[model samples]
Target: MTPLDQKINTHFPGLVVRKDLVRTVKGNAIVPSYVLEYLLGQYCATSDEATIQTGIETVKEILRKHYVHRNEAGLVRSNIKEKGRYKVIDKISVALNEKADVYEAEFSNLGIKRVLVDSGTVKTH
Candidate 1:
């Protein structure tokens, strides 16, 4: 355990986690630092190296399965096309433009830039 880890465990007990766990868990979550730290505290609030490593993996897995990434939309679409169906969790928005007679789509986290979509095709999240 690093000095900070030992310090936190010594002074704060179960209230805080090791610093390395925070770094390992932060990827594409786009969450505030405190929120990530709080979750780390919940899952990895330990000074033991083995326990901290396990907690890091747990947090990373949670983010991988649940966090939305702007770069993964194409991969999800490809999977759906290849496999006929796939599970995806995302936030999607589309607006119908009567004047243009087309649908404009926006993916909040997928970084899609105003795609012209066929009308009544699919509205998905």
Candidate 2:
């Protein structure tokens, strides 16, 4: 384990992420760092220290590559098309309006809503 992992495991056994660290961080809009880190940990955690480190590096690289900046949505869209599949990290939530027959998708940063997404995606998730 990395020192950070070891420290976390020692102090907060069975807890996946250090959620408390999120609030202390200051920024314009804080979307819990623990959420991103926790996702990274899901892909990286291993009994083998070297593999874990490599996995951590790989996940961070993916985040750096795919996480969009304002002008980079086109790049991300191209990547998704090229890769045929991609995991997009966003504040995605489902909501029902007065017309309860339909489900709405809310993409936080992209500011998109009620786009036609395949029902299979929801079922799989």
Give the clashing residue pairs of candidate 1, or none. Answer: none
Error of 2 at 90 (Å): 0.8
TM-score of each: 0.44, 0.54
The clash count of every prediction, one per candidate, is 0, 0
Off by over 4 Å in 1: 1-13, 27-32, 73-125
Off by over 4 Å in 2: 1-31, 74-86, 117-125
TM-score of 1: 0.44
- lDDT string, candidate 2, 81-105, tens digits: 8998766666778765546565578
lDDT of 1 by residue, 34-101 (tens): 65676688777876768877877876776676545667767766666898865544556888877987
Q: After superposition, how far is residue 5 of candidate 2 from its true place, in Å?
A: 8.8
lDDT of every model, 2 decimals: 0.68, 0.57
